[model samples]
Target: MKEAENIFLNLINQHKGIIHKISKMYMKDAEEQRDLFQEIVLQLWKAYPTFKGNSKFTTWMYRVCLNTALIYFKKDNRKVDKAPLDENIDIMDVNENEGKEEKLAYLYTAVQELNAIEKALIFLFLENQSHRDIAENLGISEVNARVKLNRTKEKLQFIIKKNGYEF
Candidate 1:
């Protein structure tokens, strides 16, 4: 039991960045992001016993994290107020320069307009996952994954451009 606990902790610590990115990609607000992050960790802990070593830890983790994100919507207290555009936006990378930061900020902002599955596709694609890997993670055919990804990219571009920034 002790060895299992230690192994789990070490694995989670090593991959904590992936969890943070998933939480951030799914939740826009800082507080909500934190809540979702905890929820994901809890879910992972609950499901950890089922991880048979058939796949890489990250491949398994991606399925769990993305599923949690898809189902982790707020518990019914919908917000009617919107934050102003000038409010601080969290970039995926902290070390990027101002120019790239601004671009990434806008990109993240545009990403919020995407549907949950679309967001997952874009997130995985950005992670450089192959089409087959994405298909496996998404539980879809490889051709379907490619088609959906291409369409999602077009839609994301349209959303970004509609928000007045050139692609």
Candidate 2:
């Protein structure tokens, strides 16, 4: 139990940002985001024993966090009810220096328009995982992953244009 706790702590410390990122992507409200983050951590702890360490820890963390967030979002079905633009929405002025927070906010808003699966694809893509890795992680064919990614990108582009925002 001690060993498992240690490993979980290390993993959480290293990949906590991924949890924050996914939660922000899926949940607009602060309370919801906090709830989702706690849920992800709990799920990760529950599944910790089964982790085989075959893949990078961050990759594994991403899979777990994404799955948890997606499942939670599906169960609640509250995305449609949430405000399209909330005070938490962070818009970046591209004219000035772009920081991580600004990029993350823009990315989150763009991803909010995507379907669940598309959002997962875009998340992995942004993580710089190879198509093969994404396919394996997502349990889809490499060809399908590539196809979906391209389509998602196009959709995002269309969305940005429709919103009158330049990427």
| The 10-residue segment with the lowest total lDDT in model 2 | 81-90
- Model 1 lowest lDDT segment of ten: 82-91
lDDT of each: 0.79, 0.76
Pull out the clashing pairs in model 1: none
lDDT of 2 by residue, 1-167 (tens): 88879978997988888888778778777999899999999999987887898877887888888889879989997553222321222223333555756755666777787777777877787777899988987889999888777777777666666776665
Clashing residue pairs, backbone N/CA/C < 3 A, model 2 = none
Candidate 1 lDDT tens digits, 21-138: 7877777888988998999999998889999989999999999999888878534333322322221222234245767877777877777777778788888988889999999999
For each candidate in turn, the TM-score is 0.83, 0.83
After superposing candidate 2 on the true structure, give the runs of residues whose Cα lies further than 4 Å from its correct spot.
78-100
Off by over 4 Å in 1: 74-98
Q: What is the lDDT of residue 34 in candidate 1?
A: 94
lDDT of 1: 0.79
